[model samples]
Target: MDDIRLLPATGLEGLIAQLRSRGYRVMGPTLRDDAIVTGEIRSASDLPQGVGDEQDPARYRLRKRDDGAYFGFAAPAQSSKPVFFPAEEVIWRGRRDTAVTPDSAASASTPDNAGNPTTAPASSPHDPGFTVERDQLDAPPIALLGVRSCDLRAVQIHDKVLAGRTYIDAHYVTRREATFVVAVACSDPAATCFCASMGTGPRPAATDPATGEPSYDLLLTEIAPSDPDRHHFVLEIGTEAGRDVAHAIDTAPAEFDDQHEALAVTAHAASQQTRRITAATVRDDLRASAESSRWEDVASRCLSCTNCTLVCPTCFCTTVEDVSDLTGATAERHRVWDSCFSEDFTYIHGGPTRESVKARYRQWITHKLSSWEDQFGMLGCVGCGRCIAWCPAGIDITEEAAALGRMRAGGVLPTGDHVPTGDHVTVTS
Candidate 1:
């Protein structure tokens, strides 16, 4: 750890004020609609202090913790994907007119048949040509607080897919570059979480495997047991911007004491999760099990509602739509999040290729676990457990991988709902 600092819980106010003073909007975990959600936060009081959550397969509930620690819980229902890659965004907009050309700018004059300059048509006061609204897109610098390690990695994964050299998504690139990330250690992961097995989290990792360098600007670790009287936070500055924020807050250097030791203890406890990807080569195992009966087994219980993909931070599938006004003069092209689970997602000239739930489920899981390595040089899942907790069918990815492995091993499985006995599995994949 470089430049470790001890910040009292009250120091959060100074941190927020410093970020705001620097033209950065502070967003953190807050209680909204009976769930922990990331939104605009004004002060430390806006954070969900003394609040945690209980999460299981297809189940999640808010609960009060014994202590008043601000970051006591596991991941919230929503990930930080929305902040960088929104559910829907207007990439470009244009206005059509008989009086002017589509390529003409708002300031340009249209030629009347004689090539004489004519007054530019007033189309709702704004420009007629395609305009990139930076303010509407919120392209300013943003400070993301309380970001989990798994989600922090997810943002990088999305960058690889969207902002890669092959085909760059300019919007994602700008937002990602402008965004400031602050990671919070997951002291207590949920039952559905498998970040430990995925090698993504439980702790805010020092170096990102994707980038081969520090992943966050700053990292926060909660220490409650260490200072039983008052909750303390260990802040680590990873970048110069992080150091500037610490200086602004008048933070002091932290010593390697009981507080850091206590934080380590809580972090270790979070790694004792039962759910895990047992396969040594999860990617190869998934590829070999393509013909296994596990697909049918999982499809029987799968709803194909796209909940898992929507909540998943690494899922980057999307579709573009062109919507025009009633006059058909003004139009906008929007990019919306899409899921492979939808039968229409595979739609071609004729019809959807993967019509059956078995095929669709198989494709989705295989792509996430197997082919993603070939395409992106990494596994798609970070093991944040958002897919398991958000899935209405309670399909656990760990158990599914285990079940699929067994079916591929012997070409036989527990059929007719005999129930998995002694498998130590709580959720089905």
Candidate 2:
């Protein structure tokens, strides 16, 4: 059964040490280049202590907190996407080698430039034989520390899309299965955050029933100082592995008051959030908004720089590139993250199908909110607010969805003069 324990601030080091002792490469939030980013953590001191973040549309800044909490921020600049779904990875390697039979090698010999007879090599590029080999993934087991609720849910969404599907990504499956998650409750939800409305969090849940796996091995909830000795963390054991680590760390059974305070912290965060998204009808509304003029208005400001998709934990579009050596003897294939905002993403025989920026934007949002559910049984966005804070143009998905709702309520429709035809517009919902 799951159990709760209280750990003093000093016990944080022991938690990390336990994970390390178990041969897990622990990664956590660290201050890097003015941002709290996820990176390798050797000790508890590497965490961003006393540092918090202020985030709004197109704005993100770090600030010092008086609480002296290690995980007082809402969300980091980057999520755990790069850990499981890396930006770039080699998928396979190919080589064109010269083929020589055993008899040919034994009886036939080629003359060297010095006129000396030399037995033909077994393999050379000139022989017109090609072979491709899949690259073996060699990654250490990982333990994620201080992951927020929205991002943890985002990882679950990726698991459904990438690993739990008819066609599986072996690389993603391998890393995800070998990972241990340490989730921290959000006590500092940013202005851009709307995860509460999405039913994702402010409070964190330990298990995902869909996947039959514990969402986090250990869950942390930081309680503010009620007294000199009262400042401590409420740690919840979600799995057997978490129980093992808990035994190694210095912890006591959580007092009734300690657990109450932990719940209050997440409750306050939920209450502080003013942003909400009514996403129930958004899918159908977006499908009908194909002819909506709001796409043009938003496209005018969108730079299509793809920052939103890059920071998004659930955006899993990818593109592959093939490279060959100068002599064409060796070739390699790499898979890299891609974005739907790119005009070439929907390219057909005659140039790009979505030639206009407006069409590309519509396609991205439509697929993210509408088609994604149909394809994967869940919405693509987890309401992490990364797209809003990182977008240079400050386009807010919630605001855009509200705009569509208002238009639908007013019975407003776009004029037919701008009706798009040919391959210039995206017709797919």
Candidate 3:
């Protein structure tokens, strides 16, 4: 039902070249600092070969695989979140005060200066507002070479918040429009992964029922370990732009053979992961069980370090800080990533709204799992397991969700103000 092609594994460098020739800077997973990290890549050799990662709650380790497959691992710690919505970006620069003259003062007198030079004072050349100019980050058009299925879904979830109506992030839209996502079917899912249960991935498909389109421009399924000598990659075109890139690569019509079937079987192993996050009624049930003792229990372990939110691909909470030099002549407004886990995130003028870690933890988990659907029309988590893998307290979101389900099923945790007492958690699991 789709245009499929066979790109021989040996021809991967050619494919990279094809994308680069089309004005794309490739980003892919590579081995760095004993961990697999995303880096700008030029060729297949730049990718992590013969490498696989073992990820569990609060732990991750990279090890050599028996085969030299480029995408034989789960997603790296950093996803395309940093690639698209950067961790830190300067929105615009400003000046506290500027030299003012009689001309400037006359122009600033009224909303419309009615001056001979220009109608609007802000539109004038030396206007103070004009001093605040958008900083040109100049990020090149990117092509993510080996994005995993969960990570791809995370990008789509971000699209709802950043690109959807009500508000649009100009920076995010610019990078997103120019980017070409090449998603890879995940054959190896970490222990913390539950994208299957979340209805996100194991395989990156070009079409979906809810969204009505693919999360990526091209979907790749690697066929290997069965054929010792021949490693083949089958790609499905999702967009016209993707077709253009494919045309540049040396590809043959993909054959529906045993090797192709083997790739599916390998990918299915990720879906069969023992760890599962139950999606049915999770939203409504989580909202009902907000006062459960599980919150206190989890908060006891939670250090409020904010590692979970930082690693989460879809969490987009940010704060703007006005920075100035010693003389205060020059200033710049910096857009920085913020986390709900921080007590000061909800700080009022007097003091923090969430004085205790328990309340802060409650706000984060509830907003992400339950209320996010109402706010964004989709679940916040794509089940990439980054929150679980990176949480210093090793607090598993799936386990916490499961606890909520158990509590609600037994007897709805008292639906009133939160009490610090953790008595109900003992009977939960």
Instruction: Please list the C-alpha lDDT of all candidates, in the order they appear.
Output: 0.78, 0.83, 0.78
**Higher-TM-score candidate among 1 and 2?**
2
Model 2 regions lying over 4 Å from their true place: 99-127, 225-228, 415-429
Tens digits of per-residue lDDT for model 3, 251-336 = 87766673466467546766557667677678987889767776767788899999988988889999889887886667898899
Compare the candidates by TM-score and give the number of the best one.
Answer: 2
Model 1 pairs whose backbones collide: 396-428
lDDT tens digits by residue: candidate 1, 1-429: 348887777787888888888888777888998898888878889999889898898999999888777888888888888877889988887766343444445456556797676775755454444433333555567789898888888887887888875898777877777677778888877888888787788776777777776788888887773355666678888889888888779567787784466467446856567788853577887888776656666787899999999999889889989898887677788999999999999899899999989888888888878898889888888888888898898888888877676656655643444433344355423
Q: Which pairs of residues have clashing backbones in candidate 3?
A: none
RMSD of each: 7.3, 7.8, 5.9
Candidate 3 lowest-lDDT run of ten: 420-429
Q: What's the lDDT for candidate 1?
A: 0.78
